[model samples]
Target: MSKIDQFMSGRLRERKDKLSIRNLSTNILPVDFCSNDYLGFARSGELKHLINTNLASMPDYLNGAGGSRLLSGNTKFTEETEQFIAGFHLAESGLIFNSGYDANVGLLSSVPQRGDTIITDELIHASIIDGCRLSHATRFKFHHNDINDLEDKLKLSKGNIFVVVESVYSMDGDMAPLIAISNICERYQANLIVDEAHATGVFGANGRGLINQLKLTDRVFARIITFGKALGVHGAIVLGSKNLRHYLINFARSFIYTTAAPIHNVAAVRSAYQYLNKIDHQLIHQKIALFRNTLKEQNINAIDSESTIQGILFSSNEAAKLAAAHLQSKGFDVRAILSPTVALGKERLRICLHTFNTDEEIISLVNHLQELN
Candidate 1:
């Protein structure tokens, strides 16, 4: 056989050995217990219609971004969306990116220059780590969500410190100590950036983010919000000062080189925000409350979460796999979150709650998990 075949065969065996091979498939089961469409926006036919309608008005921007924004991609709609997003987050400005992953890599990699110090939470997304790898600054990781630990690290950090963290911990469904973290950043005169990927559409009264919930937006240097999660679309935006906005457009590689996201997608995001502002948001909150109550009733209560994500810790990867399979067997769509996604020995069954999930479905899934362990 060819060397390519030999490589593929060897990799297959390695996956079998480590249980690490990934394959994609669609298994339509019962009510979803495993998607990040927190407010049911992903499946909203109304929002889709809005996108289709508004798209016709922008025929000039159809097809592609044409080229990078620095070339010809930047358009009137891009500016409008950026203005709307920035104002929503109460930032001086906003920079659009293709996805949350891209925004993290683009900004983190470029902003912290050589001889500067960069500190991030241990539980930050892998994209941030990769960005740090490309950065010119020295990288350090503080213990997750512990402001005191972060302060201690910051105290020892060198020139031009930048502290990075998430408004919501994606894996654990818990929040960071934002007020305290901002204070620490303030005391040391360090800049702070918060990733609000999972907190959007579920935290602030206007579904702005956890920072708005805590009234801490102005205190931080930057905040990143993804449209794919609670907003239920694709792409992301970084909220910051106008100088930082201008800087990223001019210097951030991902923004400068990438084909600006299609104009239609940007329009869809604008529609999503419009729907958010007018909808009865409490409906999702009520659904999440029901989900948490069911978890407690089944004695499978999650650890330290106040958001829509409910994680049931299985501790061992094997056990988590078994639990996930059991949920699937019972006709649920939940999946096991294994290591390399989360740290080893902390694997879990991440149950994502949506606004439309029935109370009965929620109870059935939790009771099934409880019965497994």
Candidate 2:
């Protein structure tokens, strides 16, 4: 066989004969057990109207940011968005990025200078790991959420240390110990960077995120908040001090090189924030409670998670795919997170709950899982 064909064959063989891959676009309209639109803002007609209203308020707010932010891409809208997000997040300033993945890559790659030490949780998102790989810092991973392990590592670190973690872990649907991690960072005089991707629009009084809800906004060096998951839009912001913002503008390669996001996309994200800023955050809390309550009642031991992500662990990849397929057939769109995404033997059916989901739908989905179990 040709070299290219041989490479593909090796990948297939490495899948261990347990590759439970599926065909694309199997759009089964089931109860939403797989989307990250936790607050229903993705489908909000009100948010859509707000986008139109804002543009109507400024008819000149045109189509695109044409180039990079430092070049032709920077517009009045960019400054306005930064100011709005800064106020909302209670940061000294906010720097917007094309997306959370870009923000993580840029922040991790740029912030950790040569000779600096970067400590990250073992189960951090792939984007962060990739960014860390690109950084010049000596990198290390602590046991997930184990503060003692983090403290031990920090003690040996010799340079400017940066600790990185996510507020709500996406794959496992667990949380980093923000309070404990913050304490450890403080003890070591290290700057903490928190990625609030999965926490936005689900935590805090106005869904500002876990740090804001806990009143720990002032404790971190930077926070990466995504508009995609909970806010249900496209991009993210790095909330930090004005100096950090300025430094990122000058040094963050990803932000400096890429063309800015389209103005309409930016405005839609702003609209989601505006709508969320006025909604009943307690309602989102109630939905999370209801979903978890039903998951428990049905005896599907969804791993401990208070956020939108919940995992139904399976024995193997095939079992995970089968379980997820069963959920789909029963009118739910749960997804199987397989090996490599998670460890072997820990494959899971990742259930994503949403505020739009009714108690009946949550109950029905869990009951179906119960039958399968």
Candidate 3:
């Protein structure tokens, strides 16, 4: 075997020994408690119809962007779409990237300099961590959602301090204390960057996100809005000042180097944003409340969440996996989230609730969880 092959095989074996090996599967079950389509937009024929209608109106619509935005890919339509999204979110300007990962990495890596400091929640997304690693900045992590800890970190930071957090955490589904965090950053003169990936289509008027809902947009230095999650499409956008937009255009390597997203993807994002305004977001919240109440009635313990993303903690990876298998066998699409995705003993069953999910499904899922617990 090649030396590289031997090295890769050794790492795979170690993952297997830890019961943390990862694999992709197309074997989706009948019911879905496992998707990020919180509002059923991904499966909505109406959204598909809107995208098609939008595409039909565009002249010379191509299947792919011929080059990077700085090259042959720049289009009036794409720029207009970005402006529309920015206006929708009440931001001064916006820049679209291929995905949420790209947006986070590009923005975080390029904005902070060598003498700067980036303070993030301990549970910030892996993409943000990668971005920070690529940066020349000093980095520190505060306890998740702990305002006091965040303030403490801020006090110790030097240079241009950038405070990063997610509006709604992916694994636990809890919200960051944005108001408090923002206030703290203001006091420290730190730049606040919020990842609204999970909050984009789940909060605010017309799904402007939690930051917008809380009227914190002006105070925040930047907000990353991802379309792949609740928006049920592909791509992402960083919303901030027009200066930040121009800065990313020139400096964010991930944005500057990659091929621009296809025109169709951009069209879909535009359509999703339009559809987002029409969705009755309260329905999803209702579903969340029902799930929480059912869990309470059934005496099932789950990570407290006011959002569509919910989790039931398991003591070990084996326990979480067994519980997931049991649910899958019962025809639900629930999956286990095992360490080191989460810390050891913090392994869980991540349950995503959608507007289309029926009360019966929520009750049944909770009852099954009750049995497992």
Candidate 4:
């Protein structure tokens, strides 16, 4: 066997021993408590119809972007879509990337210089972490959502300071104290960058996002809004000053080097934004309340979350996996989030609620959770 193969096998065996090995499966179950389609937009027939209609209306639409946006891929339609989305979120301008990961990485990796400092929440998304790593900036992580801790970190930061956070944390599903954080950043003269990936289609008027809901858009230096989660499509956009848009176009390597997203994705994004105005976002909040109330009534402990992404903590990877298997066997599509994706003993069953989920489903899932607990 090759020496590299031996090393890879050893790593795989270690993951197996820890009960934390990862694999992909296509066997989706009947009930969906595992997906990120919080508003059912991904499966919405109306959304699909809107996308089709938009595509048909476009003249000579191409199946793919022939090159990077800087090359042959730039189009009037794509540029218009970016402007429309930015206007929806009340941003000065916007730039689209292939995905949320690309947007986060590109923005973080390029914006902060060697003397700069990047202070992030301890639980920021993996993509943001990767972006920070690629950057030449000094980095520090404060306690998750702890304003005091964030301030403490900010006091020690040098050069140009960038404060990064997510509006809604993915694993814990709790919100960052954006108002407090923004105030702190203003005092420190730090640039605040918010990842609105999970909040894009779940908050604000017409699903604008938590940042827009809080009316802190002007204070924030930059915001990354993704289309995949609640928007139920692909690609992402960085929203900020027109200069920041121009800066990313020239400097963000991930954006500058990669092929531009296809015209189809641009059309879908445009359609999704139009459809966003018509969605009943309050329905999702109702489901979140139902799930949390059920857990409380049954005396089952869960992570505190007002968002659709809910988590039930487990003591170990094996326990979380077993609970997920039990739910899967019962025909519910729930999954385990084991360490080191999260810290040890912070393993959990990540339950995602949706507007389309019935009260019966929520109750039944909570009952099953009670049994596990």
Candidate 5:
């Protein structure tokens, strides 16, 4: 066998031995304790109809973008839709990428130049970490959500510094103190970038994001809004000034080299935003409050979170897996988040609450969790 094949086999065996091997499972079970469809936009018949209506209007609609946006993929309709999204999100400009991963990869790898430094939260998403890795910038991580640590890092940072963090962390579901961080960035003259993946469609007056909710749009350097989570679409956009948009267009490799999102995907996102503007999100907020109260009343030891994502850390990967399996057996779709995805002993059952998730489901899931404890 090839030497490469032998190495691959060893890696696979190591994962299996650690009970951390991953695979795709298509089983659709009764309850959903795990999913990023926080607003249930993915399952919305109304959104489906809106997408169809938009696509039907486009007589020249294609299944895929014929080429990268810098090539043949740029279209008048798509550009106009981007403008609409930017306006809705209260940004001066917006640039869409195929996914949150590509947006982060493109933005991080290109924006921070050779002499720059990136100071980030220790627990930012892996995509953000990968983006930083691809950059030529010097990187430093402060303790997660600790503004004091961030301020200390800022004092020591050299060159053009870019501060990175998620508005709502995906795993822990806790919000970053964006206003405080923004203030520090202002004081230090460092550019601030926030990944609002878990915050979009779930915060703000119109669900713009945490940055928007806090009224710090002008203070932030750039904000990344992901459609896949709350918007329940398939892409992401970086919201910033027109010059920054131009810069990314010229230098962001992920955007320049890849095919732009298809017309249908863009239209669907536009429709989702339209739906977002009109829909009442009070029900979702109520559900979120209900879940929080349920967790508290039951004395569950989850990380404090105002957002929909919640996690209960386990002592070991095996223990988390067992607990997750038990919940799944009871007809809930909770999944085990294991180490190296998370730090050792921080393995957890990552439960995602949704707008469509009923009260009974939350009660049952929490009840099952209490029993596990």
Candidate 6:
């Protein structure tokens, strides 16, 4: 066998031996508890119609974003969509990227110059971590959401300082203490960058995001919003001042080197925001409460979360996987989050509640979980 193939096979075998190997599978489950379509926008017929209407106006010759934005991809629709998002999200300006990963990678890797320092929540998403790695700045991670720990790190940091965090943690489904963190950053003169990936379409007026909802837009240096999550679409944007937008345009390699997302994606994002404004979030909030309450009433030990994303912890990867499989077999789409993604003992069944999910389904899912436990 080729040497490269042998090495790759060996690594995969090691992962399998640990019961932590992952594979892709598709299923048509009866209940929806594993997707990130928090408000059911992904499956909305209305959203599809809106996308179609927007597409109808575009010339038939344009299928792909012909080249990178710097080359040929920067169409008028692209700029308009970004401006619309900025106005809606209460930002001075917005810069669109191909995805949330690209935004974070571009922002983190390029913004912090040499001799600068980055203090991040240890539990922040992998994309942020990767971006930090590519950066020339020194990086330190404090305990997750611990403002005191963050303040201590901030006090010791040298050069320019950037404090990074996620508004709503993707895995744990808990919120960062943004108000307290922002106050501390102000004291330290640190730039605060929030990744609003999971919170974009799940919080604030018209689902602008937690940063906007809390009125901390002015204080934050930048905020990253991804469409694939609650927005139920793809692509992302970095919201900050016009200066920051210009800086990224010139220096952010991920943005410069990558092909821009298609015009169709831009149209969908625009329509998603319009549709998002019309959604009554009260219904979704009620559903989240119902699901959390059901787990409590049944004496199921789930993590404390008011958000739609809830984590039910297990002792090992095997236990979490087994529980997830059993739940899936019962026609629910609950999935296991195993170690490497989370800590070993913190492996879990990550249940995602949705706007379209019925109270009865929530109850049944929780009851089954109780039985499995």
Task: Give Cα-based local distance difference scores for all models.
Answer: 0.87, 0.87, 0.94, 0.94, 0.91, 0.91
Give every collision pair in model 2.
none
Worst 10 residues of 4 by lDDT: 279-288
How far off is model 1, as Cα RMSD? 1.6
* Residue-by-residue lDDT tens digits, candidate 2, 124-161: 99999999998999998999999989998898886899
Q: Write the per-residue lDDT of candidate 5 for residues 179-265, one digit (tens) a residue.
A: 889999999999999999998998988788888889998998898988898898899999999999999999999999998888989
Enumerate residue pairs that collide in model 6: none
TM-scores of all candidate predictions against the true structure:
0.96, 0.96, 0.99, 0.99, 0.98, 0.98
Between prediction 4 and prediction 6, the one with superior TM-score is 4
Clashes of each: 0, 0, 0, 0, 0, 0
lDDT of 4 by residue, 1-373 (tens): 8999999999999999999999988998999998999899999999999999999998688888999999989999999999999999999999999999999999999999999999999999999999999999999999999999999999899999999999999999999999999999999999999999889888898789999999998999999999999989999999999999999999999999989998989999999999999978788888988898889999998899999899999999999999999999999999999999999999999999999889999999999888886
TM-score of 1: 0.96
RMSD in angstroms, candidate 4? 0.7
Estimate the TM-score for candidate 3. Answer: 0.99
Distance from true position, residue 263, model 6, in Å? 0.9
Candidate 1, superposed: residue stretches over 4 Å from native: 1-12
Write down the TM-score for model 4.
Answer: 0.99
Ranked by lDDT, the better of candidates 1 and 6 is 6
Q: In candidate 1, list every pair of residues with a backbone clash.
A: none
Global fold similarity of model 2 (TM-score)? 0.96
lDDT of 3 by residue, 141-219 (tens): 9999989888889889999999999999999999999999999999999999999999988899878899999999899
lDDT of 6 by residue, 186-285 (tens): 9999999999998888888778889989999899999999999888999999999999999999999999998888888888998898888778878888
